[model samples]
Target: MSTTTAPASATVADAGYGSARRRDPVLIGLWISLVLVAVVWIAPFVFIVFTSLKTTGDVMTTGAFTPPATVHYQNYENAWARGDFSTTFTNSVIITFIKVPLGLFISAMAAYALARMRIIWGKLILLIILFGTMIPFQVMLAPIFTVVNSFGLIDTYPGIILPYLAFGVPYQVFILHGFFSVIPRELSEAARIDGASDITIFRRIFLPASIPVLAALLILDFVNTWNEFAMALVILQDAGMWTLPLGLMSFQGQFSNDYGQLNAAIVMTVLPATIVYLIFQRYFVSGLMSGAVKG
Candidate 1:
């Protein structure tokens, strides 16, 4: 048979056309939008890093975005001591660590009952939870404070932790219930057939399979409990019992603000949250993707 071949120029042109068509316009636009948004979002952090290195006077004289000619490592040291962060960081850590685990366990139990077991008014309870999430935390602040005060729990770890658990549980339960409901019923049914108790199945089957979900929630609850300020402000009046957020108030004096120390403190405050987010970033993203795929 006689051979017939296209010119190299025509082949190259055809390949280029195919490659251009493969780059979807919508996807390209989305990437551009995301890059622009990321730059805008990161601007504040960049400004803070720059400001933390500058002196209070320099902040006024120089622009917000300007880099410092002389870096101030002293700012971190001053902020650490003046802020009294040791006590506050310990208090915040204790509250967050204790509350996150307890909250997760409670939420998982509730979600399991709602998702897997039959119970009277379970759907109604779930509906209530769905609505409860929409209610602002500010709405419950007065009642929570009143109850904490009545119980003489002010300035105690339980006072703050209890409220955190109460507010955080509903959303955790909602997410867990959705994830649990999508899991195959046969797994639990078979475990039941083998004479396993509900708790056993929860521990052995459901929980083991829900690692990504649990890890994501763990990170989220930890961050929330750590960053919570309003409830802590209302509950913890004792300086020894204050959390990091409360400790930040020390930066603002009656006459002037310590911009250097304030920005440094802000950076310090972000460290733990950023570390946690980085640690669980894998599970967080996977868990969300799993839910999206399942749904």
Candidate 2:
């Protein structure tokens, strides 16, 4: 049978109409808003990178927002050497590695007990722990200092790591509790039936299932411990024990600050944290979404 198709002009008109009809104003507005927010969020980092690349003279003459005539890559090397970052970076790494694993392990155990086992005043205990997280660390700084001094741990790694564990545990417990509570009770019961101890079950079953949430917790706690300044400043008096944040402060001086070197240090300081977040971001998002759902 012979067939007749619509004219080219008619087909073109229909395609245009369909395209226009599918365009939603709300979605367009949302995209525009996101772009704007991204620009605002990213502007400071861009400015910092540009400033890091410029010579001190260019920065004073042209301003921070302007692109550099030539990228001054040596600023990073200079900053690292001048700031004594090698020592600070090592201290930060040691503290983070020790504290993050220990803190996560402790918090996970507490969360599992509260979430899966029958215990007296478990809710009350959990509530108290949550309250600990809510209290500002600054309020306890003086007392913490006194206690650390009493133990003669001042200017030592233990002084900082101990406090990080104390402050970090409560929040980690809170987050892990939410994720753990939503896990199927039947899984644990089946493991129990098969002769698995609580620790064994936690190690084998729960830990595997909890990877996403654990990754999220790791990122959060790592960033917090790594970037923590006030506590490190107060607890660590020795130059040998200073963390990256404290070391960065050394770049600033009374008469003249090395803006170029300082900005380079800032970029280096942020790089590790940024890389960590990027690595775990997928798991972090999924963990957050799962935690938000009602158990």
Candidate 3:
């Protein structure tokens, strides 16, 4: 006499149910913590956008916590004009467009050389570049300013751009070099055997394969260049030549106490960087980590 066994379907269902029942408390706590953290990060931006729509008087009297009685759509338009964002935005556009491609190409080439080429003292050169990243930009301000002034580049687009390019290169090289190292050397040898030069191999083979890392660099560098204030403020003395960040100081005046206007200007000022990040954010994350993990 033998006992009957449960059906396979029933056994599977019971196992699944048991497994599902054993949820980890730590994971649940982590998810809860993440939600709280997300809320904490997002709350200020929500407040800024809502507060930006309120009238200046409403901001002063009703307070930042209070919602606007009427949505002031004109605040943005007024802020745009008063902030001189039209000129400043053009300057930002010019700087970003010129510097991003230039910086990315230069960094990629340098990274490719350091990663693949058998150069004399290559490690020493890489060490120098890495060391550059560790030094504070503020610390170099004096020397950078002196060089810019001596070259008579101050208050010009190139003046701000040169410094940004110089600062940007080492970081981009560091990241791109990591990605380049993981690439198969066989590919370069194959291309070389096919009579491809170093530049052609880099342009055709390496550059195409390194899009993720490049995209990450572009997004990061764009944000850094856009929001950069201290250097721009120091280098750009002419109001007409100011970038958006520098132009934002116009919102603060001796007589005007318009928090709403200032907040609206801030919203406009941050909008481009926000849109860029949101659009490329996925690439930004994946590309940043692509170099870290190797097969």
The model with the greatest lDDT is 2
Query: Which tens-of-lDDT digit does each residue in 1-295 have in candidate 2?
Result: 1233457667899999888878877779889999999999999999999988977888888866888999999889998888889999999999999999999999989999988888899999999999988989998999999999999999998999999888889988888888888888898899899999999989998888888888988898889988999999999999999999988887655213667888999998989989999999999988776655548
Error of 2 at 176 (Å): 1.0
TM-score winner, 2 or 3: 3
Query: By TM-score, is 1 or 3 better?
Result: 3
Error of 1 at 97 (Å): 0.8
TM-score of 2: 0.90
What do the candidate models score in CA lDDT, each in turn?
0.87, 0.88, 0.87
Error of 1 at 294 (Å): 7.4
- State the TM-score for model 3: 0.91
Worst 10 residues of 1 by lDDT: 248-257
- Candidate 2: count the clashes: 0
lDDT, residue 36, candidate 1:
100
Candidate ranking (TM-score, best to worst): 3, 2, 1
What tens-digit string does per-residue lDDT give for candidate 1 at 1-295? Answer: 2233557667899999988888788789989999999999999999999988989889889998999989998988888888888889899889988999999999999989999999999999999987878989898889989999999999999988888888899988888888898999899999999999999999999999888988888888888888888989989999899999888765554213778888888888878998999999899977755534433
Residue 31, candidate 1: Cα error in Å is: 2.9
